[model samples]
Every structure is written in structure tokens, then in C-alpha cells.
Target: MKIMIDAGHGPDTPGKRVPDDSMREYEFNSSTARRVVAALNDYKDVQVEITFEDTRDVPLKERTNKANAWEADLFVSIHANAVGDYWDDNVGGIETYVYLYPGTVAPKLAAIIQSKLIAYTGLRDRGVKQEDFHVLRETVMPAILCECGFMSNHHEADLLKADSYRQKSADAIVDGIAEFYGLSKDSPDLVPGNGNQTIDKGWWRKAMNLTIEQWRELAAELNRMYQDSVSGKIIPPVLNDYRWVEKAYKTEMTPEELLTVMSIIQMRRIV
Candidate 1:
């Protein structure tokens, strides 16, 4: 599949910087866009191209034109959002946008990317939205614009400046695209395992240093948490806490169990 990645805005774009002028929106967008290109390259049968190759703030028409001319299968535009030009701690989250009158594929792709971004970054779920963005409207193929975080929000501004956050955002975007297309990696190590492997209960017990009864108890607690989350009775855990949960039981978790854990984590409200 051919993918076009556009890092929104140019380095010199006016009023696109953080409140303190510490970082430009393109600085984050371009970095994350490059990471997305690098990750997509690892997948088989995938050809990736980035529109913002240099510092020039390319026009929206030119970017979309290139994608259309290239016959790209999909287009993704990366951006850091802002509320006005001032810092506001309360205004922050990640959101993805499709054209106001998008085709079937654009909304689906937007939803996937939105979910992945929130799950991976533990950012606020601003949900998928409709917008009349130039990139979205002009691209012939399915297209999405991701607002990684609010640059006007102090906390998220710091996150946008961090390499780790940019990397996470890129990984989430790539994962979303791969999931939408069912793309597989060229490397063996990245391939998912078949589900038929037998679980060695004894080994897992040793690995987690927990007995069968203890494992059952933990599983029961996780199930309860999942149910509570489903019922909207409790906030979901943060991604870091979810990682700890996964690390604690990954050796023993069945595919089904793993899904349950992920559901619980994603459902948790980020504080």
C-alpha cells in the first residue's frame, strides 16, 4: 500500500509556536511524521512518502496534489493543536479529523487512529470529529488529520516537545493504519504468534511468583475492573499503570485475557 504522510505547517509558519516560543508546531509534526515513515517502512508491501521533506511550509494544495498524483492509498497529516495563542492548562486532548463529508474509509481510519492515539499516549479522548480541512478535502484517498496534543496547554505542550511522546504518537498512528489495512510486518520478530500455543501454567506461576489461586484472584479482579469500566462506574487506569499490569501477567495471559486487560486499560479515565 502507498501512504502519504504530511507534517502539517512549515517551520516558519506564523503563530504556530508554543506560548513561550519554545517549540514550533512543525518541529513536533515533522519529527512524528518522519517516525511514522520509518515505522511504515518495516511493513511488507508498504510504500511510504512524506510531503514535508524540508523546512518550507508547503501549501495545502501542493501537499494534497502530490498525494493525488502519487496515487497514494491513504494520507495522514500530523499536527499539534492549540487553543488561541495562549497557554491554558485546562484545554488539552488528542483528536482526529476527517472531511466534513468524508467517504466511508476516512471516518473508519480516523476512528482507528483516534483510539490508538488515546490508548498509547494516555491523552484525553477528544474523539473523532468532522472538519473541512484542506488536506482532508483535497486528498482523493482516505485521509485523516491528527491533533497530537494542545500546544496551548502547558502539560501537553511539554509532551509535544518530548521525543518519547512524538515516538509514541508515531507508533500509534502506524499501528492504526496497519490495523485498518491488516498489514503485516516484513520482520519475523514483529509477526504475531498463532493462538494455538499451549500455556505452561507452572512456568507462568514461577515467572509471576504467584500460585494458581493467586492468579485466579488477580484475573477475577481484572474482570471486575473491566465490568466496572463497562458500567461506567470507575475510571480506566493510565497507560503506565496498564503497562505494569501487562508486564505482571503477560507470561500467563491467554489471548482472550490479554484483550480483556487492554479493554480495561483503554476504558480507564486518564487523570
Candidate 2:
């Protein structure tokens, strides 16, 4: 499959920097886009190309033109979001967008990317949305525009700048594409862990050092939290706290923290 990856915006675009003016959106987008292309290239029979090869801002029309010319099977646009005119450290999450049309291939692709991104990055799910984004509307094939996280949020901005977080983002995209195509280890040139594992089992075993039974118990605790939230026993503030939980920052997690997060997600589900 041929995939077109568009790293949104150009390096010279004004006022697209992180809250501290430390990094440009293009810097994060381009770096992550390149990593995603590299990961997808590791798979067999997959061809990936970036919409813009350099830091220069290519017009939206030209970007779509190239994808259409290549006859790409999928188009993925990577971006970092800013909610307001000013920085807001508290606002953050992962969201994916498809064109504002029903029953399109874009929504499916967006949903796949959104779920994997939430699972791998441990970000709050802003959910899949319908938007009239140029990249989503103009692409000829299955297309999705992924807002990795809000750069205005300090914690998320730090993650966006980290190489480890970028790799995780790329890995999620690759996993989504592989799942959509049903690519497996047996496929020519396919890489390992392609839909074979959902969560990072190795990371869990190595970092958390928990046994299978312990993990199950933790999951059960999360379920109980969800039940409580649904029953309206948990107040709004407590619900909000658990709704935006993040535990996999750089894959560092204490057992207590992990359990808290697991419980939070469970609560989020029922609310």
C-alpha cells in the first residue's frame, strides 16, 4: 500500500510555536511524520512518502495534488493543536478528524488512528470528529488528520518534543495502517508487533514488573471505578480528574500510579 504522510504547516509559519516559543509545530510534525514513514517502510509491500520533503510550506493544493498523482491508498496528516490564542497548560488530548461526510473510508481510518494513539500515548481521548479540514476533504483516498496533542499544554508540549513520544506516535500510526490492511508478520517485509500485540506487553512486564494475576486484579479495579462513575456516586471534579489521566509518560509508571490510571479509564468509560 502507498501512503502519503503530510506534516502540517511549514517551519516558517508564524506563531505556531509551543507556549514557551521553544519549538515550532512543523518541527514536531515533520519529525513525527518522518518517523512514521520510516516505521511503515519497515513493513513489506508498503510505500510511504511525506507530502512536503522540507521545512518549506507547500500549499495545500499542491500537497493533495501529489497524493492524487501518486495514487496513494491512504493519506495521514500529523498536527499539534492549540486551543486558544494564548497558551493553556491544562487543555490536552488526542483527536482525529475526517471530512464532514457520512459513510466514508476516512472515518474508519481516523477511528483506528485515534484509538491506537490513545492507547499507546496514554492521552485522553478527545474522540473522532467530523471537520472540513483541507487535508481530509481534498485527499482522494482514505485520509485522516490526527491532532497528536495540544502544544499549548505544557506537559503535552514536553512529550511532543521527546523522541520517545514521537516514536510511540509513529508506531501507533503504523499499527493503524497495518490493521486496516490486515498486514501480518507473514506479509513480505512486514515488521514485528504488527497487530500481534495491542499494549506494549514487554514494557508492562519489564517496567511494572507485575504478574498476569496482578494485572487482572488491576483491570478489575478499573471496572469497579467505571461502575461507580456510572452510578453517579462520583462527583464532577473526581470524574474530571480520572477522565484525563495519563500514566504512560515515557513508559515510566509506579504500580500505584498505574492502578490509579487503570481505575480512571474504567470510570471514564461509564461516565
Candidate 3:
């Protein structure tokens, strides 16, 4: 998938710094964006485009236009939120924004991102909201604007200045996107090729949305089906068609199991 990432504003953007001017918002945004891109680089067939490579300001129009011209599958703009010019300990939380459209995929994506961010960072969830932000309104694909935290908040500003916190935030964002795309870290393609590795909870959590009991039952059923197919009791479905399998059985098999089944089916077709 092609993803366009925008680090909001420029290094010299006025009124974007902490009250003490310790760190700039662009510094935080750019670093987080770079980390996110690095994390996604581990995946195969993922094409990431960054709107700004340097500390220079890129116009909002230019950023959206580049994403549209590239036909990106998704657009993510990252920024730090602020309520006033100075610091306030009371106003700190994470929020995600989508264009005010009922049927678009942006809301769902925004929800997933917001949840993951809160889960990973232990940040307060301000929830997903609809807005007429320029990036959200202009982006061709599903778009989300993530306000990472309150830069005007004293505690959050300090956290934003730290590299570890930035990395953690980036991780949450990428993991959320991976879940949206049904990309499991358990897939051999993501992590090391270990047969004993259990399926990543991401697939089960996002795609299945099943209760614990339901997941257990479905997993048993998938194992039975795989065994049956291998023992010649029944023919396996189309192996080369991942999309079909994904659509047909949304949560039946884990990603690793799906990969194994598809590989076997494809090999059988060739043989």
C-alpha cells in the first residue's frame, strides 16, 4: 500500500514552540514521521511518501496535491495540539480528526489510530472527531489528522521532547495502520520466519472483533479445515487470491495460517 505522511508545519513555524521554547513542534513531528517510515520499511511492498524531507515548510495544498498525484491509499498528517500560547498541565490528551463525511473510511481509521495511541502511550483519549481541516478535506484517499498531544501542556511537552516517547508514538501509529490493512506482525513476511510464533493479536483484535470464546471456536474450525484440505478430504479454496479469502472468512484463520494455506494451495496448483 502507498501511504502519504505529512509532518505538520516547518521548523521555523511561529508560535509552535513550548512556552520555554525548549523544543519545536516541527522537531517532534518530523522525528515521529521518520520513525514511522522506518518502522513500516520492515514490511514488504509498502510504499511510503513523506511530504517534507527537510525542516522547511511545505504548503498544505502541495502536500495534498502530491498525495493525490501519487494516488496514495491513505494520508496521515501528524501535529501537536495547543490550547493557548503557554503551558497548561490540565489540557493534555490525544485526538484524531477526519473529514465530516458519514460513509468514508477515515472515521474507522481514525478510531483505530486513537485507540492504539491511547493503549500504547497511556494517553487520555479525546476520541475521534470530524473537522474541516484542509488536509482532511483535500486529500483524495481516506485521511486522518492526528493531534499527538497538547504541546501547550507542561508534562506532554516534556514527553514530546524525548526520543523514546516519540518512538512509542510512531509505533502506535504504524501498528494501527497495519491492523487496518490486516497486516499481522506474526506473518512470516513481517517478523522472523518462526513456525512456532503465534499469530499477532492485531488481526484478531481489529479484523475479527470476536469475543474470546468466538475466537477460540473459530481457530479450532480453521485448524480442522486446514487438516481436511491436506488429507484430501476436501479441496482448498483459491490459494493465489488473498482478497477472496480475506473477504470470505474475515476472521477464521490467523495471518500466518492464511499464508501457509495460500502457499500450499499455490504449490499444488503448479504441481
Best candidate per TM-score, number?
A: 1
Per-model TM values vs. the true structure = 0.69, 0.67, 0.68
Q: Which runs of model 3 end up more than 4 angstroms from their true locations?
A: 184-271
User: Which ten-residue region of model 3 has the weakest summed lDDT?
Assistant: 239-248
Q: Is candidate 1 or candidate 3 better by lDDT?
A: 1
Per-candidate Cα lDDT values, in order, are 0.76, 0.72, 0.73
The predicted structure with the larger lDDT, 1 or 2, is 1
Query: 1-271 in candidate 3: lDDT tens per residue?
Result: 8988889999888898888888888988887786676556555567777897554788889999999999999999988888878878989999999996667888888999999999988988999998999999998899999999988998899888876678678879998999988764322322322464443332333343555433433333343343345456665533222223222233446666655554553343334
Cα RMSD to native, each candidate?
13.1, 13.5, 15.1
Give the TM-score (vs. native) of candidate 1: 0.69
Ten consecutive residues with minimal summed lDDT in candidate 2? Answer: 241-250
Give lDDT tens digits, candidate 1, residues 151-202: 9999999999986788789889999999999999873222222463332222
Candidate 2: residue 132 Cα off by (Å): 0.5
User: Which candidate order results from sorting by TM-score in descending order?
Assistant: 1, 3, 2
Q: Give the local distance difference test score of model 2.
A: 0.72
